[model samples]
Structures are given as structure tokens and as C-alpha cells.
Target: MISSPERGGTVSTPTLRQILRDQLAPADPRILCGHDRLDVPVRWVHSSEIYEIGPLLTGGELLLTTGLGLRGLDGGTRKHYVHDLAERGVAAVAFEVGRTFDEVPDEMVRAGSAARLPIIELRSVVPFIDVCRAVNTSIAAREVDELRMRALLDDALHDDLAAGAGVAPMLGHLADLLDAPVVLVTAAGALVSAHGVDDDSAAWRVVDRAVAEVPVRSRGRSLARLVVGERAGAPTVPYAEALLRAAAGPVSVGLTRAGVRGSALAARLVEDLVDGRPLRRADLETRLAGAGVTVGGPSVLVPLAAEAPDPRMADAAVAAAAFDSMARSIVDATVYALVSVPVGGPGDVDPVERVASGLARSTGLGRTTIVVGDPVGIDRSRPGADASRTLTDSLRRCARQLGLAASAVSPAGAGRRVHTAREMLVDEAIGTLEPSVRAELSALAAPLAAHDERASTELVRTLAVHLAHGCSATRSAEVLHIGRQSLYQRLERIRVVLGFDPTEPSVYASMMVALRSLAAGA
Candidate 1:
């Protein structure tokens, strides 16, 4: 953070009404339109005689002009000029009329009203340079006052720290000082604590739309970020930002002294979700914050659950690697982790693969299986219950696949221990079927099973191989070491007994699952 000359207080931006009420306002000013919006703050003062100067502006400028460019313009052109200025977010337009026109144009006034832009008519012959100087000087003075106020506030917060105040109390004090909701979110965007916020979702909303945000760091690593809202009732965002920046030093110092251990808390959070335990929104937010895993504001969560002879290998892998945000907890003999990666970042890097490799390496030359469930996309705008439900449901789904992924972890060899739930997604889905549903699917292949048992014909095996090779008669015959004509004959007899063509796409899919389910049950 840039060093401030002093610590905590705030000065509001100078508005047009405030300026007009004082001697800094231009002489002989008359409100032509938009009188109700005089509270708009002036960022800077600019004087332009060129008619097409709107595009050159960068919003919030108080445009001053002697009307030299509006002389004899057509009605449409004058309206367009007014519209251009308004659309560019100029705070207000001060038009001097004696040199170019007797009064402000009716077309311009109507356009200003239509755009909700303030138009001030200068009836006297006022020099544009003097007006710019006086207004700019006032703006600069207010900025200095704002900085001084922020320094005072910062100092007060340090005093709070000296008085044995914790982070939560300091947040409350900050909220009282600013008269707004204040929150602390981890760098990953998880809520640590909040003041003036009602619940978990509201805290996230504050983070999502925070007008002022400052990072608090210890020894060059981020500890947390301080957020302030615009609803302070009086403090502008600029002033709030200045105060927060100054406050970060004390916040960092406090966090270091408090010894915030994020990794352990994060790990516990991931385990709880997978254990099918319901967690409150506040509890969830706090734990996720501790783990440095963010589920808010465009953050996507990927849950990975693993078991191994030694879970420390997996723990070491995550601990040693450079993941932006990851939390690991060893629950029983299994380690559960929730990794956060940004959306629309490097799409080529598969998170599942990245985490799988880490786990595989951590348990090198040992028995370990890692299963990454479906990627859960968190919508921060949802209600607290809805967000919490989404997280719990996703993790539970991942938990259900643990048994299956574990069974198939060493498909290639014992060395190939890491696998994604997606590799067996179809089977994972099949495993979720109700017991009666699975029985019905298994029954579909019962006739073949019986035929093979009674006649010793190997029909079930024939059908399994045939469908597994996409109904390729030649490949089926080669694999079964049977005559081509015999394979065809058996396939025809099997179709007749099954009462449907097995090669049809939908029937093929059903039969494939049925055969697998039948084999699994057996």
C-alpha cells in the first residue's frame, strides 16, 4: 500500500450544490435544467470551445464553455451536443451565453432534461479560466482533507489494536466509523468476518460489490483483504479506500499476532462437506476462508477425495505445490481437498489432471487413489441456503463415487493410481440407481445368462464381447475365436430370444449397462 501522511478520517467529494453555495462557483449562474441532481461530485473542471469535445472526456468532468461552438448550430446538432456531454458522464455543463446567444437554447435544455444532465447557464461575461481555477483548487483541497481523515482513522484503528481489540471488534469499530457494512475476505474471496452484514450471503454480496478493497499482507504474503461498502451514508468510495489501505497494516499485524492457521481449517471444511454433514452459511464461509478456497464471484470449485496407505504423500504434494488456492484435510485415512481455480483463465490446464498428478507423486511407489468429482460452479448471487446446498450436494456426489473410483484406480496397473470420476461416469451414474432399478437392468440379460448356463453355449460372453466392440461382427468373432458364420447364427438366435435388436443404439446402450450390472452383481 502507498504510505499515507497520516491515519484515519474522510472528506467527501465536493458536489455542485456545495460549490454553488460558496464563492468558488462561477458568477451569474442560473439552473437551466436538472436542478435536483446538483449533488453530483465534480472530478475536474474543463473548458472547451470545440463542439465535439465529449469523446475526449473521461467522465466526471465539469465542462465549462463560452458557447463559441454552439453559435448558429441547427436544432438537431445542438441537441446532439448536449447528449454527447451527458453520455460521457460529465458532472454538469456550464454554458456562458452573452457572447454567442442571449440565453440557453430550448433544444439544449430539453436534451439535458432528457439525459438527466445538469445544465447551468452563465448569464454574465465570466472568464472560463478563472472559473476552472477556483473549482479545481476546491477539489484539490477536499482530496487533501479526505487523506488527512483516512490517516486519523488508521491511527485510531492502531489504537484499537493496542487496547487488545480482536479483528471482529475492530471490524465493528470500522463499520461504526464509516457508518457502513465492512467485511474481511481471504484473498480467495471467502468471508472471514463481517460487521454490519446480516448473514453469509450478504457478506459475499458485500465482497462482490465492495466499493473499496485493500489487501492486508504479512511478510509479503496475503493474509486477507479489507472491504468497505458505499452505503456508509456519507463517506465516498475514494475516502473509504484510503482508510482501508491505511488500516491494512494494523490488520496484517493483528492476523500475524493471532496466528491465523488457514490450511487446517480449510481441510476440515472439505472433509465436513464430503461427510454429508450440513454446515451453516457462516460456518461454511469461515471455514472456506480458512482454507483459502473461494466459491464466490466467478470461482469454480473442484472436489478431490483420496485414500492411501499413507495420506501424508498426498498432503505433502498439495503443501509443496504452487496452487493458487487449495485446502487439504486428512479425514481417517483419506485426504479431502477443495481446489479453487479461476474461470476463463488457462483452459488448457485441467484441474483434475493437475491435482491427480500431485496426489500420484505424493504417494509415489505407494498405494493411493484420487477421485475428482464433477466441477461445481458457484453462483455467488444465490441465497445463503442455496449456495450451501449446492456445495453440500456436489461434495456428496463426489463421496458416492469414492468406492467405485477406488475399485478402478489401478485399471492400467498398480502404478496408475489416480483417476477421475469422469473416467467411470457412466458406471458412477449406474451405481446411483435405486436397488430395484438396478435389479430390473440386470434382469434384461437374464435370458442370455440362463442360456449360457443351460446349454454351455457361452452366449452371455459372446454378447458382451460383441456389444463391447461396437457390434463389429468380425472383431467379435476374432475375439471369441469363433467361425464368422457361427457368430452370425448366435447373434440372430440371441436377438430372437431377447425380443429386440441388440445392435440398435438405444438398445445397445441399455444392454451394455445391463450386462455390466449383471456381472457386478454376480
Candidate 2:
């Protein structure tokens, strides 16, 4: 049986019994069969005499018809006709018998009974239009009631936002209004907030049975999902869907605001350690303590580059990787996390390895490169900031290496692996050239850059590829997806622009370094 809400809340549509007793009482309506389904909500009223009208209906309509269409049909056909209407989810079939038949057909009655579809007969004089008007009026009234409830819910959410009470109170208010539990979970399935339920309780099972789910998105990428429990009765799916749709925007904004606040604080901690500012050990310890990070311990600076098509998704993946770490920050496309772990103890895995393992298992970032700095003591003697800077530089170099490997024809060595800062120091030095040297290098590529700006040519990129592949024209052509002749022509163009042969070993080496430096933002 369907149960409806009280008057103050959204009202459900009028049921067949309610329509018969309240609206069609003057017509002396009586149930001919299927008395058990009187509570089925009548979505609308449709008047038709078409024998095969099932396909025309969108379901949940009370069908009103005279017996004229059944006059020539056999009993089996008549039964099939009623069965078709029932299968189409007609709330009830009201038949007026006097014009076409002396009494209700037993075949239709038997079919309605078998299908448990409500069948009614209008015995008194009543116009079909009158019944349609009454049902439509009732449906409109229910819609108005739902609109009022929705308005009230929207107001409550806005008030909560203005009052600075956060999303929990708004979710609680929604839970009370709908009389169902609500849960907000991150894209990683981490619980952000819940109302009227405990995660461990049986009531939370209702979340698993959510009738509506709305995505909470930020920067055009989904960050979380809001799940609303189904109401016990009264055709609540539509109401639930509407409520979640309205709430999703505010919820996403709230989550983003919270993240920004947290990220700002984390960024401060990271900046203090990597910005080359002199930070006394005592002052650093005090700030770390305030940020809930323990200092004077073995800490590994882990730099990670995760691949994501969208920047927001990359941020989210990095955030997930930083969970439970001492401190973390997103600098450009890379994420750095300072993780603390036991040093050199039995069964003590490398801190960077441990964190990378966790990130690999949790984040679905397709190709990632992790650079681990040597473990350092965060004390007065050791320069923690300098070490962090070195780790960051190493991460940048590894990222460039990974990018180059991806663009190569032979990418057999592009698999993800952890590298130490020492292993990448030479590339880091070359990429992080002094400002005066970088200016000179940029001048060398000025002609190609100007050409790219004017004609959108690939001269600079072609030169970079040729140099990166050991000046092998064939390999560069294969990587660039161009013929060797086209590659030679581009090389000739570069030679004219630079006033030198690019394939010469001395010139190739210098130009390659300059291009690599430019690519690394030197």
C-alpha cells in the first residue's frame, strides 16, 4: 500500500480510491474488481476507446472508456485488451456500460483481477470530462504543494550558508524535512558528511539503496556524490531526485570552500620549507606544531607528478595522495608531500616508497613519477628548506624525462618508478640554468619562436625532437609522424633561421640544452 505525507509536507498524487470516494462520489462509482490496488497513485486521467492504446500512454494514468470498442471482440480478445491496459500501468479503468453493453464484461473483469489492476464502473450519469477535470485539479494541487516544500528547503539551505554553520546543519535540516538519511561522499568514497544516520548503523544501508544521487562538481569535474535515502512510501523517487538536484550546487561550493581554506594553510607550511626563506629551527617547529606536523624527526620529502586530463582532477588526485601525510602542497602540476616514518629500523620501508605505494593503490592516475629526497633531520644543523628545494628540482627533471619518454617512438622504458634526487641532479642543474644563461638560450630560439607565433610552424618542436633523439633524422621523423624528407626540410628551415647547421654535434648539443631549459621553465 502507498503511504502519503502529511499536509505540511509534499503531498502525493490522489489514489484511485480517493478519486472514487471524493471526486466521483456523485457518479456512484463502485469497484468492479482489483479492490486491493485502490492506493495506486493516479498520475493523470486519459479518456480513450482505442483497443490498443497501451503504447500511447506514458504510464500511471487512469483510463476512462465506454464498452463500445469491446462490442466486436471475442472474450479472449477482451481479456487481452484489459491485460494490455494493466501492463501499461493504468491506475484504474473506469468503464461506462449503458451505451454499448448492458453490464460489465466478465472477460475484462477476470483479466483485471488476474493482473491486480483496479477496475471501476460508473453506474450513475457522469461525464468523462468531469472526472478528468477533478483528477487534473488534484494533480496540480499536489504539484503546488511539492513546489512549496522545495522552496522552503532551498531557503533553509541558503540560511545555513549565510549563518556559517556549514553543510552538516543543512544536511540535517534536509534529513528532517524528507524523513530520510543523507550522505555525502568524496569521489574517493571518503565520507565528508552525513545526517540522520551512522555509517555503522543499519539505517546507513539506506544510503546503499539511495533512490537519488547527485554529483557535486568543481571546475567541471565531479568531486563528490550526494546520496539521498528513499522514503518509505508515497512515490518518493521524484521528490528525492528533485531535492538532491537542488542541493548538489550548494554542497559542491561548500566542499570547495573548505578545501581552499585547508589548502591555503598547507601551502603556507610547504612554502616556508621550499621558498629559500631563512627559517629558524624553533620558529619552524612552532609553525609545524600549529599545523599538526611533528618536527625533529626523520621525514622524507616526496615529489610526485600525476597525470590527469583536467587540472581539477589532478588536484583531487594529489589531495588523495597527501592524506595522512605531515604536510603537502600542489605546485603547478606536481604534488609534494612530507611524510614521516621510522628510519633504518627493522621492517621500516622507505618513507617515500611507502607513500608512493599508498598513492599508487589509491589514486587511479595512469602514469606517475615519484622522486624521493634523502631522509633528513628537521633540526638546527640540517637545512630542511634546501633539501626540499633539491627534491622539488629533481621532481621537475623527472617530469621532463617522463614527458620526453612519452613522446618518443620507443617508450619501452616509460614505466613508472621511484628515483632519488641524486640520480636526477645533473638534469636538474641543466634545466635550472642561471637567469643570464637562460636569457641567452631563449635568444637562440627567438627566430623559431617568432616563426611559430607568425605561421604556427613546428620548427622549435621539430628541433627539440631531433636533438632529443641524438640527431637521428629517421628516429625524429618516426616520432613526429612525418616523412624523413619532411624532417630534412624542417631541419633546413631551422638551419636558415639559426644561421647554422642544426645537425652539427656542437650546435645540436647547445640547442638541445637551451630547448630543454625552456621546456623546464628556466
Report the C-alpha lDDT of model 1 over 1-522, residue by residue, as the tens digit.
Answer: 123332365446678887666633446789989998899888888899899999999999988887888787899999999999999999999888877888888999999999989998877666778767877887787777766666667766778779745466667666765667889864433345688888967887888888888888865666478999767454455567766777787766654442212355775676567556776666776777766787566666777765442345445544544567877665433456677766666565676676666555652424445667656665545554455566667655554555555454221221355667675566666768999998998899889888888888877777888887878889989988898999999999889878888778878888878876776562
TM-score of each: 0.40, 0.43
Candidate 2 residue lDDT tens string, 1-522: 112243345556788888888877887777989888998889999888888888998888988888777888899999998888888888889887778876789888989999998888888767889889978987888787667667777787788767756567767766766677778765533344687675534444765788678887776767668887866554264466677788887766655442222345666766455444555656656766667665545554445443232223444555665556456554432344555554656788876667656665656454334454555455456554554445445444444443333222112112444444443454456545778887787677778878878988988888877876878888999988999999999989888988988678777667766665555445
- Runs with alpha carbons beyond 4 Å of true place in candidate 1: 1-10, 24-26, 141-238, 241-522
What is candidate 2's TM-score against the reference?
Answer: 0.43
Which residue pairs in candidate 2 have backbone atoms (N, alpha carbon, C) closer than 3 angstroms, thus clashing? none
lDDT of each: 0.70, 0.65
TM-score of model 1 (CA atoms) = 0.40
Per-prediction count of colliding residue pairs? 13, 0
Return the number of clashes found in candidate 2.
0
The deviation in Å at residue 398 for candidate 2 is 28
Best by lDDT: 1
